[model samples]
Target: MNAFLQEVLTPGSIVQLATLASLIASVNFGVVGTYVVARRITYIAAAIAHSVLAGIGFAVFARAHFGWDWCAPVLGAIVAAVISAIIIGYVSLYLREREDTIISVVWAVGMSAGLLFLYYSPGFNGNLESFLVGSILYIAPADLWIMGALGLVVVLLCLFFYNPLMAVCFDEEFARLRGVNVPLYYMLLLILTSLSVVLLVQLAGIVLAIALIVLPAAAGLHATGKLWHAMCLATVLAMIQSTLGIAWSYTVEIPAGPAIILLSAASYLAVFGWKWWQSLRAASSLPIRS
Candidate 1:
């Protein structure tokens, strides 16, 4: 700490704090990833990430024309994500199968359209690479506040809807019979999930966001059977990864976002292997009937 104070704090104290504030966005993403996996909404996460480009591009256009940063992206992202979710819902309902395949089509088509539109709009592709790959250390404080608020909202709502969600994930038919309003629950879930993608991808970039969300939840799930336990473990794992990734990124030459996610993934794989071995050994110990 003293050494860093002696050396790399050149932009003055405020600038350093401001610079560090950028990383809060990534932290928010890490926390959000848990619920995403818990609900088995990874593809939805991916789709939302892809769809954000159109939202961002449209937002940028709005910003240029009207100069309101927050409102534009909020409206655009909600529109894009809701439309995708609704389409995915209806298509799946009618086809009664292949939801993932249908969602993928939506994801691909949305991104292609976004890219094409961006190609035509001036500066539409500006730093688009960062959105796809993530450059979290560049997130501004204003952006951090926004991301933090969104994360809080999502997590809070998850807590409120915890029971129904658990039922929905475990057995939707049972939940529906129990008067869980499965479709409405899912609608709310998708909305929050889409919002999460927007915020997380903003930090880790869309590409890295998947790792941050999935690896921790998967690892946590391996660690425990209970949903709350899994959620807690995933959050802790995310925080560990986020803090370590930031530290390592500063210490090494690698980008912070991917570095953290890769580290989390490696950790998850090690634990997963251990869990599998444990399960196998336990199964082997069981007596066989003659």
Candidate 2:
């Protein structure tokens, strides 16, 4: 453990990068994930995550074809995510009947558009593995700084609007009756979800982004009933899983992204098993009705 810390603590090292990425992921997932699970909008988050690929593709194409040095893929991803959230939120609220259909269509078309754009972009010869599966080892200082700012924004928003968000998530009708803007809050939730998806994509890549968002939050919910308690627990759990996954990956020489996701899954299962055992013990302690 000491050696691991020493290696990871070095400035600008891959281990440092992984650590920063995981920390940012923990913040984003911990806060936004709680709302996601509460509102049961994991599918919407997934749709936004995939749709971000379109933005990345466009950014890449623009940079390659037009020599736009300012076209950062992450910036493009944020724009795409926000736009996708608006479309999904609008449809789900005003056109409830077609919500599912729109999500499905966006999910598919976004990825397809990304792939096509990448194929046609001239003078581009970068591997897509990192974007698809993630490459934490290659994370630069710039990425870490951007992620940090975004993570701070998520934390602040959640803290500032906790009650309204909780009301919206647990009971939209109640929230509406209480004079909270239901539609606005709902859109805010989706927009936050979009940002969280973008952050997770950096940590776990497009393919496994949802796992980072959902698994830790699921474990938190299983362990606790209170929303705030669950959110705090989920954040801690995500940090643990991410750190452990990076350590295990270093030991075994495996990809960090998959390792982190698999570890998160394992942690969730462990929590579930413990919860089940507790229930069984409680049931066993009860007197037989017969």
Candidate 3:
């Protein structure tokens, strides 16, 4: 723990980088996550998150076999994420009856495709584990820059489309009636969700990405009724969880991603239980009625 603190205090150390990554990543997690939870599209987000691996795997294969120096995994992730979001959004909008089946297909195919690509790629693919379970402590400065840029884009877009998005989430029919392009906004929401999920995959990896994205926002929702309030609280909770999780992981020598996820899960449960207890108390306090 002391050693970890010293490293963190050092300028440009991996520990510092990890901390910064978590903080920067938290903004998107909070904002986009609020929309995801509000629209009840967490399953879609999860599919997008896993589907990212397909892009990453293809990028790796390209770089290895075809010598495509420009095909970075992050780029592949962005491409795959956007494509998955579009497909999922289309199905949800027009093919409502097959929503679950389509989502399941996307989820499975994405994972399967990524694995097959990796298998054929001629190399040990050392970074696969990092992408799978995350290795924030090993991220470079370039990763930080990309993450920050993506975070900025996502937050700005959310702010610009706040009213339309809120309408879409709460009442799509009403939004359409009011001349707000409901389908466009809905697709926009899913795209933003995909970008956010990519950031989460970088931090927590695919398996744990959904947890970080949903838990904090869920907790915030339980604590507040307003959308903006929920976003703010969720962002703060994400940052706190990231920091504490890093600290705990360093002290105990556990995996940082899982530690962060576990902390988030515990916090959400605690907040949920407290809210439930309060509701029970409020109900019990209501004087004898009828």
lDDT of each: 0.69, 0.89, 0.91
Q: List candidate 3 stretches off by more than 4 Å.
A: 288-290
lDDT of 2: 0.89
Candidate 2 contains a number of clashing pairs equal to 0
The residue pairs in collision within model 1 are none
User: All candidates' TM-scores?
Assistant: 0.82, 0.96, 0.96
What is the alpha-carbon lDDT of model 1 when measured against the actual structure? Answer: 0.69
Pairs of residues at least 3 apart in sequence or in different chains that clash in candidate 2: none
| RMSD, one per candidate, in order | 3.8, 1.4, 1.5
lDDT string, candidate 3, 49-162, tens digits? 899989989998898899998998899999999999999999999999999999989998998998888888996355678888888888899999999999999999998999
Deviation from native of the Cα of residue 278 in model 3, angstroms:
1.8
Q: Sort the candidates on lDDT, descending order.
A: 3, 2, 1
TM-score for predicted model 3 compared with the true structure: 0.96
The true-versus-predicted C-alpha distance at residue 262 of model 2, in Å, is 1.0
Better of 1 and 3 by lDDT: 3
Writing each residue's lDDT as its tens digit, candidate 1 over 1-290 gives 34334323655343243234434443444445556677677877787778776765676666655666565554566577767867766665457678888788888877777666556556454667876777666655566566668777877887889888778778888998898888887777777777777666665776776667678788888888887877777777776676666666766657767887788888899889999899999999999999
